[model samples]
Target: MTDFENVMIALPAHGHPFTNLKERSIEIIDHHQERLQTIRDASHQLIEGTVTDYMRVLFSERAWGDMAESETYAHLEHLKESGELTRASNNGIFTYTNTD
Candidate 1:
C-alpha cells in the first residue's frame, strides 16, 4: 500500500461527525465572507486587507469584540485548517487570503 493510504488507515475515526463538521465549517465560512464584504462595502474598495486593518474595523463596529489579536489569529488558523483560507507569516505578521 502507498504511504498515504497507510496513514489514513492508521488514523483514528472517533472524532466529530464528518457531515456535521463540514456543515458547521461552511456556516463559519459564510459568516466570514459576510464580514469581509462588510469591510469592503464600508471602505468602498476591493476585498483585500491586512489583519490589523480589518481588526480595527471590526473593533470599531463592536463586532466580534471578544476576539482580540490572539483570538482573531486562532480563528484565522481554524479557517486555514478547514481549507477555507490560506495564511502566511512574515516578520511575525500574518496575512490571510480566502481560497474561494
Candidate 2:
C-alpha cells in the first residue's frame, strides 16, 4: 500500500481510540519529519542539477540550515499538506519511494 494509505489506516488503529488529539497530531508531525529526511536524502542521491532543481532547495541552504528542525521539516510538510508530493511504488530495490 502507499505510505499515505498506510498512515491513514494506522492512525485510526492507534490505541484507545480517544487519546489526546493534540498529542496524536504531534506524533503524526514527528512521523512526517522523519519521512521527509529519508525522502530528502534519496532525492539528493538520485537527482542532479542546480540547487533549485530540488524542491528543498527553493530556500537558501544556509537559511534552511538555520531554521529549527521542526520549521525546516515543515517545508516538506507544506508540500504534503498542499498535495504537491506523494508516495509511489518502487520499480526495483527501494521502498517508501517517490518521483519528481
Candidate 3:
C-alpha cells in the first residue's frame, strides 16, 4: 500500500490520535504567531485562507503524528470562540486573524 494509505489505516477509529491535543494546538498557534501576524498586517484584516491551508502552514515544521485535520480545525474554532483568534468569511472563503 502507499504511504498515504498506510497512514490512513493506522489512524485511530475515534477522536484525535495525538496526546495533549489542546496544549499542542495552542503551541502550534503560538509557534506560527509571526507568520499569522505578517498576514494580518499585510491584509489589514483577516488572514485569507482555509482551515486546511492554515493547518498545513502551522503544522508543517512540527511532527503531529496521527492528529487529524478535523481535530485541528475544531481546536482553531475553540481558539476563535475564546478570542485567541479572529475568523471571518466572505464568499464562502474563510479568513483568520490573530487577536494578539
The weakest ten consecutive residues by lDDT in model 3 span 1-10
Compute the lDDT for candidate 2.
Answer: 0.46
Model 2 alpha-carbon miss at residue 5, Å: 27
Considering lDDT, which of the candidate structures 2 and 3 is the better prediction for this target?
3
**What is the C-alpha local distance difference test score of candidate 1?**
0.55
**Steric overlap count per candidate:** 0, 0, 0
Candidate lDDT scores, in order, read 0.55, 0.46, 0.56
Candidate 1 residue-wise lDDT, 1-99, digit = tens = 122322322322554443344445567688877765554453333234456655666565556454555555555566668786676777877777666
Q: How close is candidate 3 to the true structure, as a TM-score?
A: 0.43
- Ten-residue segment with the worst summed lDDT in candidate 1? 1-10
Q: Write the per-residue lDDT of candidate 3 for residues 1-100, one digit (tens) a residue.
A: 1223224223346656654445555666775565544344543333555566655644654744346455556656766787867788878766666776
Instruction: Please give me the total number of clashing residue pairs in predicted model 3.
Output: 0
Off by over 4 Å in 3: 1-46, 58-67
